[model samples]
Target: MLKRLALSAALLAAVAGFARAEDVTDKLKTSAAEVLARPAADYVESRVEIKRGDATIVGTLTLPKGAEKPPVVLLLHGFTGSRDELPIEGTKEGVFSRTAHILAARGLASLRIDFTGSGESSGKWEDMTPQGEIVDALAAFDWLKTQTNIDPAKIHVLGWSLGGLVAAHVAAERPVVTATLWAPASNALYNFSHFLGSEAVEKAIASADPDAVIEIKLPWGATTKLKARFFQSLVTVDPVAAISHYSGPLLVIVGTKDTVVTPQPFAGESFLAYHDGPEGLMVLPTDHAFDAFTGPQTVDLMAAASLAFIEGK
Candidate 1:
């Protein structure tokens, strides 16, 4: 019935000269253009696992489509966080996932991993230490460099919180193209002392038992358990000092309201003093995690800055 109605309407229109054949062809052309204007997914992602001596690290790898050996970024999550990170209240995706999509949109690939003891990775959370995370990140970087989809000379590492510290150290250890840190804790021991309490960390270091666990309750009510080495490692591993060895491009992003990494942008900006390469320090008014509590727009802004820096803009 609908087809017959369209036929009868076309016949009437022809007789009345209300519409012309060229006009129908123009309408079809406009509809085709509208269809072509819509955007489609231009990247592919998969769950990948990397084997380490202690435990297996699980992560997501997102790669841009139709790029020859596209540059890739290694995304390291914040302390006690998963690869994708927590979902913003109003959004369906996590911060790292969103970052990966943003990078892919600009023809870059990304790999975001859950450090050992977090997310689906093996090992207990109590054993996590900054030194170990650096090792894990190095392994991931090495793996990325060897992957057929990546350009070995173009791999970058981006991290947040403690992971930012790890990324900085990784840059020092490897020939990374660029390093991006989000609200980084340049001074890990000083930063952790504020939350873990100096007394707790000191007690752990002073303890004679290597198997001893120092349990500290976070303000959010979650308890973090780690060995004395965790604190000791934090004290010994300084990203600001280590970053001096990394002469590649560096981008450090900080939040003014961040209490975890105190003194505003200095926790981030300190890297500039030691580096002799292209670098930038972006300071925003939002809190740690880029105010994920408020909205994801803040993260998007940071992502934009990150892409520009990585692109050498």
Candidate 2:
């Protein structure tokens, strides 16, 4: 009889523990959903198209309501990522989109563009290169300069992943007041070597034809062709060195669990390169795509941190 009673008590405790754990999980999900469900009532979103050389770049500009000559943040997405980072369509809850809305809510304007080959932009994926992205970003910045509603002196640039490197390169040449790099690819050579084996990269580099294409099988089982010039371009440009030239305030945001752009050499080195600028580093407890791998709360945290940095708080 006593053994039966003890077994019943143990089972009850286990069930209660599971129930408690479930309750905690439910709360977290609810909180994260709430953050993503916020409305963008205080901002006006406009679809924009800018001509960059032969390609027509498409994007969105979010301008805050009742703010005259407000500062604008130019957002650049990562490699293979569009102006919207999330895979879901017609949702403004993605990292870049959400950040833009959040910034608008805070009375700041923001512009997010699709690079030539990605999003709604026009170009072949195989033709996209880091150098090309820099050119596209500069074109967007130049276009922003012509906008009468924007404060030219307070223009800022924010880049994520590969886009982070492009943003740094643009800031180096352009007159950006501030720059925020999230999970930036500090070394393109290192990234290429990791994605495409060193042997493949070496062969591409040694090839006589600059237009030679190499077939690369990604981790997600998709095979894509890239030009030999892509690898060559990676070797020529150093993102950290380029970023060092920008005298504006810099904010580096990296995820602690980011294996895509390893925190050690990439994030640490990129953070170290901004020696001349007033720089700040934020290490979040998440992965490379903070919200994608973790949850919406990670994005909420990121948005909060970015807003604080932009507002100089």
Candidate 3:
């Protein structure tokens, strides 16, 4: 009986090891498919840094395939988000990924990165500000210019949510090839205040520690130990003013049914006002995240429209 038990244990261990190996192999195969099937656009994974006095802000850059000098795009994500948001399984296979890959198909290279302390990045979120994030995007652009495969004059910035604010600011400061903001904030103060008033936000605050406090009076009564500089920096940011100075093609997309940044009251004319360049506006019957990308839309209008604008069609 003892010998039989020992044999059974060994067999189970061998089977478990085989199963684990198979799982790993499957993941690798899936990843390879995603890359190998990446159309004509080539891609590379790299890193960059932005000097902030003695500190260096770091980020990742994913370049598309092309032999000649390619147009480079800097992709920015919203607060409490990272580049991972773009590559998420469903999200990636849906609109944003398709949009990016299609850009690659058109010879545009995109650099999607995490902010300091976000994702694989270093630095504390409390130590970063919206302005800091913009500076980082600028740094990524500078790095792109140094690459032999990229055209300095063909650089663009694509910001999503709060990232839009960052992209707008960068476009204003640099000679970007184009610009796009996905469900961007019309006004920092308004958006922040709006979020505070939401039921979800109230729950977050209620569940937070009582000792925490925010520097700025949030729209919601809740507060946190979030640094004072972060709040102060946001108070002065004006996305409309920032984008008003950009002359390249501009694309603004927002969901009509978005409750997070409510389109009708938050977007509408305000979006039309700042997008003075060649512009495109897409209002989908979706939410902030554009969950509709998962549906059987055949082709995502937002992605199609964005790709068309970015490719200058």
Candidate 4:
């Protein structure tokens, strides 16, 4: 039954054209491929298990070419992203994966994993929660600590979109990570409301009832009970509050033209209020995904700033 619902959701996402998150990932992949035709240092790509009590979260770990302890950075994808879904740029890597490769090339080990129920992990997305994802991250951190070539004190967390919220929560809970957020949502309530409302409005701006937005039913009819719970739980979460409690190195990046997660109107003050140190926030002259691949320049900036912050440079 769960598998059926998941499949139906995928079909609906495809038909409804509601999956804007990955709308441009394919383009980014094509662009990245052209940028990554050359060879860099050797790296290992594998799956690691993170145990959260009864459930095991499967994750992808990418290791740099080295035989000694290396600074480790954990990369997290946005909502609805998979471990392999992130592009490694056959020629030009996408932002998330590009950062991972850059870290590996600079002698840092990186790991980007799937959420508990998404990607290749063995769970149902309907049963997952942001808090559950946080536990998965902790499990990953513990696993990384056991690696022979990973330095525990030099660990960092980099999250994009929804992953940024989870990253902030994990950093708050652990308090030992150097954290970076790319186009992260701060106030969960406002964020979700704006997301649903904006998408609905974009589709209904010409409708007779302008206020009547977000009128879509669920994949299996009305909103599933589980989805209701998910939204309810998410509505109460506050990533900005979580980050405010974290006292480690932090960074935030946002595109100036981002309509999906624009920080200016929705979360600008929250971003400013929470980052309490020598943090970095770069506003790129692009859209939500940084569709403008002017030489992978935006991602390159994020990588450089993150490395500097993690190494206290």
lDDT pick, better of 1 and 2: 1
> What is the C-alpha lDDT profile of model 1 across 204-313, one tens digit per residue?
77878767777787867888788766776776788888888999888787778987777665556567767777776676788886888878877777776677677765
Candidate 3 structure, TM-score to reference: 0.72
Q: Stretches of candidate 4 above 4 Å error?
A: 1-40, 84-94, 198-226, 265-269, 292-295
**What's the candidate order when arranged by decreasing TM-score?**
1, 2, 4, 3
Candidate 1 segments exceeding 4 Å error = 1-41
Tens-digit per-residue lDDT, 43-132, candidate 2? 899999999777899999999988899999999999878997774233437788888877788778999999998889999877889999
- In model 4, state the lDDT of residue 18: 22
| 10 residues in a row with least lDDT, candidate 3 | 18-27
lDDT of each: 0.78, 0.76, 0.62, 0.63
Q: TM-score for each prediction?
A: 0.85, 0.82, 0.72, 0.73
Q: Report clash pairs, candidate 3.
A: 42-64, 42-65, 213-224, 214-224
Model 3 stretches with alpha carbons more than 4 Å out: 1-42, 47-52, 86-99, 198-225, 265-268, 292-301
Worst 10 residues of 4 by lDDT: 17-26
lDDT of 3 at 149: 67
lDDT score, candidate 4, position 211? 32
lDDT of 3 by residue, 119-187 (tens): 666677667678778877777777777777677778888887888888888989888888877888766
Candidate 1 lDDT at 90 equals 83
